[model samples]
Target: MLTKPKILVVEDEIIVAVNLGQKLKKLGYDLVGITSSGEEAIQKAEENHPDLVLMDINIEGNLDGIQTAELLRNRFQTPVIYLTAYADENTLNRAKRTQPLGYIVKPFESDQLRSSIEVALYKNELEHRNRKNEESLKSTLNQMESGIITTDENGLVLFCNPVAEKIAGLSYAESIGLSLTKILKLEDSTSSSYTLPLSDVLISNQTIEKNGIFAVDGIGNKTAVSIQISPILNTEGKSSGSITVLRLGESDNTNQSYLKEIHHRIKNNLTVISSLLSMNASNLKDQETLDIFKDSQHRIQAVALLHEVLYENHDLSSISFDLYVRKLTDLLFEVYKVDRSKFKLVLDIQTPKIPSEMGMNCALIINELLTNSFKHGFKGRESGSILIRFSLNDEQYFLEVKDDGVGLSDDTIAQTRNSGSLGLSLVDSFVKLLRGKLKLENENGCKVTLSFPTRHET
Candidate 1:
């Protein structure tokens, strides 16, 4: 059950107080207390914490009803409605200063009293809700990772989140009333001289986004950040303030070293695993089993080499595919013991560096294709050439591997589609992982083409 809106009546006349309490009860409001003095009103209000206070300004006490209402407004934020016989200019002006929600003459009708109390209650509820919402918004802003600062139209700091304080090296107490220029000292050597200050942006009612900007703190530490500022407008659509968002720049050296270390560790572990495989293969007397171990070792080596490139290069996140392919082909040549005089390896790797994961997958795919060509295509040939090409367009990647050797028949190609060859199955899974299409054709020699999106399309 919902409780009634409680009313505290402060009337000196006993008859009038009892009558007013009766009227409130009939109107569905609870008469929490009836006090005859200002001092009793304050005590009763503190005890009951009524939703509304019906105060008689001419009440008997050291603190008149006006003074009590003023104290209640400041301390408890209790809504007040003045009930008095006095309607003179002097009394009205004094009550107005107390900021009472409603004023009614002593002999006011029941309908008038009811309407005044309802309006005051409704307005008070709205104010409380608005205050709660503001607190919630402040909490959310303080929890954000991005530094946010809001300023008044005059560029005075109105609010700054906790992240903003850390980024600026300034406390909220010191920053609250300071100018934005003083609190957040921003400098941009790369920006043009014509670039406007954030204050100018506010005045122009324009939004701005700038990168490579530096913020200098009190201790003289400079931090790079990307800044975005937008104008905050009022209901009239006029600019009222500005909201600034700052994203800290990447930790270039620290991030690069961390990523490089990860790749280095991965490469070392893979090398150790491959060494174990090689040792196990040497003990195998069966030629077919030995070949299987060798194939697995080569696949591991292919992925290891990709990590090695990523670890050594300045770009830790990606690998230079062109240089990587060259090294990979050379390593394959040494492993297969292919005589340079009998065979030629041609590479046209004109693709940009790709992420390390993608590079590893591509390396393995290339390893399988090259291994198949060397093992089957050049089975009885004295001389042949293997050509590898990789290129990228705006939307997709294109890879082609061709060999001028004995080609397979159409029937063989069709049968291989259903064949459970481990190497071919790996290639098929990799192609699907990349969301790509593969085409194999034999025009005098074997030619394979694979195309896929350059970026993952989540």
Candidate 2:
């Protein structure tokens, strides 16, 4: 059930006040109180908290009806309607200043009074709802993480949230009414222009996103930020204004530091294991067992080298494959004690940075193949050249390891196929893990070629 609209009556004459109260009750409005003075009306209004006030312009008090209505409206947001006997120009003008909801001459009809009160109540309710929605919108915008700023069609700042004020290095009071360009100093990282293309956005009526942009402050301090600007269109599809959003381009520095530290610790632990393997290999009596230990040590070092590269680079996602290969080959030559004058290492690497997991597999494959060549391929030769070529084409990676040494014997090839040789067998397994194809050739030497997709393919 709906509650009745509460009303208070203020008239200097006791008879008129009683008549007005009776008429309000008959109109389905709850008459809270009747008063003969402005002071009593205010006191009654405060006590009753009526929804509407029927105020008489001529009241017996230091404060007139107009003065009391203004105070009630301002303090309690109460709606007031004037009930007066005079309609003189002076009295009408004074009553209008109070912004009453309705005005009536003396001896008004019941229908007229009812219609006036209904319209006033409806209008006041609509205004109250609008104010609440506006406040809720403001609160939401203020809590957003990204900086938000709105401007008029002429580019003057209309409103900006707290985040926007912080990013622009200005307060809301100082920014309003100023040109958006003056408030926000944006510099394009790819260009030399310091101005934003707001006109283009307004004309095109489209949103534009920019990355690697710098937000410069008043004192020339620049922070990397990403920005998006969209035009606010009216009902006719014409640009009315614009809204801008700003976000920092750089990620959390603390998280990046933590990741680098983790990579560094992992590398250190692997190095310790590699050193322990070398120590045990020195005390081995059987040459075959010692070679096994050496191969394992080299494999461990290969993975450790990748982590070292990752720790040193600013980006922890991937490492430069070319640089990593260079370091790996150098370590292999030093470990095998190959004389630089007799053995030549040629590298034709064109691949860029690759993920750590893929890099580790490739490193192990290279280590095993090169170790095989050093142990048996050039056992009776005085000198030979090894070529390590890695390239990418058609969304696939190609890795080739070739050595100009005595070609593999028929028996050795049979043993490799039968898994008799652990080195070649391991290479085959690594190739299969990469979802790749491997080919062995013996034109002038031993050439091993492997091909795989850049990403996993079904």
Candidate 3:
């Protein structure tokens, strides 16, 4: 479905114009129109919009066919061939200035004209396709989210995408053709100033990635950005330019701020609840009721400490269970007024961290076990040692707490399990809540080991 190439004829002689039109049609070209004067030829060319113009150098107008062809070439980019009887040196020199596609003497053959037209049309189509591809490439670069810049080996900017321009706080027009260093300021997180790695990449032809780099824009506004620099190589496998991509870094400021607010509110609420419990215990004269209230307050304190740790920690998702266990045990000793100098505490915490949810549960379990050890095992005893060990093995989280004090008898253990001893019952419930198994041994002293799978939260 290819349309024939359209041709316009500009000749003063009527016979030559008619004969040329018939020759063009026979040669499989569409004849747009024929005109005798240069002015008429321009009018027909504008009206018909032919692909090729065959102009007689000597036409009937003040503006010769050469002048008209120059006008057509500038306005429409239409290829022209000079059809003239003059082949003298002076005439050729003037015709060359118009930049005609082909020069034809009078009485030219059909094959010569057809060959010239085909060559011109093919060259024009190629130029059009090249221009289209360049425009498409530019559009793609501008639409990208990551900042993209291409600079020559001399560090002069060649291309800067819209994202790159936005990051630098400079327009593309301002960035392009300028020194890349002049437009951008880069500094490391530790405040060390340096140029971008693009210059090095050009020299070594290697790729480099730099993280935690602060990008200071033209207006002195700063942003954290990670940059990647790679060399742009030519077809000869030599470094021609460098392409740098800048990706904005993650922002933790907002998340940390929000978590701090939440933890402050929660910690305050827990402190109020603990105070209310202590006040109620003071009002109660009965020793048993006061002990119960104190136990409840201790449990609340364990949870409250979690919020405090989360608020202070850089990471909000988990806490260092080792550090937390030490702190919690010290708090318990203070609560019970037990002399910590008499009872030595040994901790071998292999599990460095667990999720906050799991940490809270572990905290309560440890509290209950330690309370029981201090209350029952070390009763009437002045010197004792307690060991707390936490570890992870084969995806299993293990917690072991041992006490070197009065060991439990077989009958006493059975009674504690069977009877609803509140402390032991609560420990059992907590083990079940964690989907774990617990064991109690009283060979040398009371030793409790709890094992659970480290289940990841969805």
Candidate 4:
């Protein structure tokens, strides 16, 4: 239910005050109190917090009704209507300065007084709502991440948010009344003769956006930023002002930093797992079981190394395959305890960089092939050479691993093809997972060739 408007009556005459109170009650208004003096009227207004004050110009006490109304308006924003017998030029002029909402001469009718009071209350309510909305709008703009600035039709700055103040290198007080160009010094990063399209936005009454621009500060420092300017139209659908929004273009740096941290954490976790496997393998006595643990450790290290490379490099999407292969071979040679003078390893890698997923698969495949050569093919040989070659052609990758050692016999080759051995079985599975073809043969020793289409082709 809606509450009736509370009204406070201030009049020196006892009859007039009582009559006004009765009139308010008849009109469905709540009578807060009646006072004959200005000082008592202010006290009543302060206590009651009335919606409207019917203040008489000629009241008792040292403080008159006009002075009391001014104080009430300044302190509590209370709307007032003048009820006075003095309608002379001097009294009316003095009353106007107090800014009363309505004025009623002596001996006024109930209808006239009601009309004035209703109009004042309606206007006051509208003003209250407008002030509330403006405060809400300011709060929202202040909390926004992007810099927001509003300017008049002449491009003079009217308001700016905290972000705008920081980006422009100026305080809110300093930015106000300054021209838009004075507050914001922006230029195209790729061109020198570029100018802001503020005029176009205002004249055409359309939003204009520019990216890859540099925002220059007062101290001659430039920040990469993007901006959008939109016209603020009035009720007549004409341009009244403009709103400019500024956004930093280098926000991607934060995302890249996060990605690097994620890669580093993944690499560390993988390293820990590899270390655990190595520890378990140290306690194993059986040669076959020990070799299996060691192989698992090496495979984990392959993926861990890829993450390590990604963490160290600026590009997180792909890695230098050649560099990765060199590191992996050195690691494998050290793990196998191969004498540098007796064993030779040759790497002919033509592919520079490949996606991380593809690189991980290739790394594991190479690990298997090299382990097989060091364990079975070179088993009893004091000296041997292994060659690993990788190249790209016709939207496909070719990888060849050849070793000059004891070659697999026809029966052994047939058994490996049937997935008789665990190592060879894994190799077959990996080749099929890559959607590639693999060939195993004996050319001077043992040779394995695998080919797969590029990642995009699949």
Candidate 5:
């Protein structure tokens, strides 16, 4: 009189079959087909189309329960649950390979059977939701313009979307599971004094940030990237791993030309204005007033030259030291016009990536030292050799200018404390900005040495 619940029961034993059928009926479920062999179960499942199949692993025929479930799954998409007497791991594992919906060990309670079925259904629902979420996440990540790379506890890259793989010049399959240092060629980035922030995410389990020049691939591409590495905590609030967020863009270039041009124009205008002031000051009797005007003009010109040079460079971030040095030497040549036999400026240098402010400091320091040589040391002749040596002195950079003409007197050395000359005072000021030491020795003519720490490595 009851509405039947169709089911296929696959068991090799007759007693177990009769008991399972009786139990399902007592639980208000119908037994549609009961078979002794896997061959019969598959045949019955194809024809009967039961709601579920209770399959036994050990059967009477060539095919086992798992094999039969696989065949039924392929043909009818029907879910299978195994009811086996043996709890041996290998037999259970074999049954699991077919992706059975549930498994029940024999000598089990009726509730155990119900629980497995309920849990299996719940897991199936969860898996369906997870699949949809995975598809959505993958689509969004692929559409992103920037890169996204996620790492595991070991710092090995676990996930890299399309953009990341493209930027890194590797396939997603090849990039995943590879250590970040080796893959990004960041070995050299941390090869120097600085350690890359990505390395810290796995160590201290803390978020770290890094911003500077990252010359991966080569200097030609030279894309600037800001990286944020944060620890990924599991549900238990423990550090499971880290994810590195990278935002990349080109470095500042527009400011380069603007800065240089503005300085160049200002320098030219100051030069003309200085000439007018000098002519007017010359007409006055007081030499002190004339000297004041000259000092102000020189200070203005110093800042002006900095602007011109910066505008010429493509990268506004820093300056080219070699070019700056040559420009100053040329300006000194025009001012003093020191003959080849008098004070010749010799340049010996080896360093790179000088900060903009530091490079300007270098220019002003050289200008002061060179001007002093012409005014004091090289007073006798317009031609004398002045050796300018720029050497790397134990992690520091040093600039030494030496002249072989007339030496400073003992009185000149003692009296020249702070205010004796504007040249010496300016040199001291620029040295302070560079965080360097400035010393003037008058043993044989005069030698000025300025040493400072480099902002970047060569």
Candidate 6:
């Protein structure tokens, strides 16, 4: 019930062509017209595209069968099976360069011919399946929530899904087969091991998961993104390079842009609230209530600053930590109007941009500590020294704020401190929000050190 596969025979000898055609016909194949010369085979192939071609090496044509096969392959993707009498080393070595599907030696029987054709057809079917698999894989990569791109062993991109294209600010044509540095637009362009998973796959011949920092995109946006990549191995577990998945905090094209606009307005409203509090604080005769209002205003601005940054960038996933910290510090100094001559505020801060969630938490904690130091810690004087150092250790980050002023009471911040404590308790809450630890040291002054683990990075 199956339809026979059409095959063309390319033999320079007339007798050989006739016999091959008869044998192929008898074997249940559709006998496409045979050609005696390489030139005729190429012409016939152009006119009538057969399923497969059986080529002869030493033909009576201007071009040999190998040359004809190369032409057919380059022009038409048709699979070729070489038909020859002898398996000479040079002939076979040269034939391999053309990637022939099958080779038939001379003085072959009907079974040999039948077996070669069957094997060639099987190989052709497998190639077809591989192509389909690639297409399907491409579709799946496109549908993923994260960006996905794969490269060959040489780090040349083989595939880049739609998400990868969109997130990386590039089209597939510009991405495929390109060196990752060229595509990623890394600053150093030093082919760093950003693709750790891809390397693991190459070494262990298995899947690997990795993370690394990507520089700002080619558009010179002054913003960098993190990339999470993994390896894709073959059936035999050979290193086949890797696929990188980019996570940009769910860019909901349908409504994310619209929602970001609304959040921008809300941040402005918070700023107005801070302004009103500042006016009210100026009018208050009682210093305690005035201090309370000022502290609350600073906290509101902390929340508002995060909103403002996210509003401007509209990337809900990550905010610029370096920008957020710098801006918040500036705002605090301006609000307090502290004398720069008498007291100095030192900041040794460093961190890459992070998500808005992490940024807001960090800003609030810093705001509270700085506000507390200016209030109770420096009760009698308007001049003092405060040093803020930011450092990371292993999986944890340390925020140590040291002030040469009065510190907390012994019983107030004891190891047995309870949830009953109010302001200190609030500080504890902020620490918990960061999933970190907090310790107050009262050596010469007040030393507030907050230690917490880093969040999920690329």
Going through the candidates in the order shown, the clash numbers are 0, 0, 0, 0, 8, 3
Q: Candidate 6 residues 273-391, lDDT tens each?
A: 99999988899999878867877887887888887766545467776555567678778777777676787878776443455676677678788777777767888986899888776
Residue pairs in collision within model 2: none
lDDT of 6: 0.74
Lowest-sum lDDT 10-residue window in model 1:
189-198
Candidate lDDT scores, in order, read: 0.82, 0.83, 0.82, 0.84, 0.71, 0.74
Q: What does candidate 5's lDDT look like per residue over 130-208, in tens digits?
A: 9799899878877775677887877888887755653454556778888876556432244343345765666677888
lDDT of 1 at 364: 78
Query: How high is each candidate's TM-score?
Result: 0.50, 0.50, 0.46, 0.51, 0.44, 0.48
- Give the higher-TM-score candidate: 4 or 5: 4
User: Root-mean-square deviation of each candidate, in angstroms?
Assistant: 26.8, 28.9, 30.8, 27.2, 28.0, 24.4
Give candidate 5 regions above 4 Å deviation: 1-9, 14-22, 25-53, 60-62, 67-80, 87-89, 96-102, 187-196, 212-224, 250-458
Error of 3 at 32 (Å): 99
Model 1 residue runs over 4 Å out of place are 84-99, 189-196, 252-458
Clashing pairs in 5: 260-311, 339-382, 341-383, 341-384, 342-383, 342-384, 343-384, 344-386
* lDDT (Cα) of model 4: 0.84
Model 2 Cα lDDT, one tens digit per residue, 275-310: 898899889999999888878888888888888766
> Candidate 4 residues 194-229, lDDT tens each?
577889999999999988887765645455778999
The reply for model 6, stretches above 4 Å from the true place, is 87-93, 139-145, 153-156, 162-215, 222-226, 236-239, 249-256, 259-458
Candidate 2: where is the Cα deviation over 4 Å? Answer: 84-100, 105-107, 190-193, 234-240, 251-458
**Alpha-carbon deviation at 147 in model 5, angstroms:** 1.5
Give me the displacement of residue 259 in model 2, in angstroms: 14
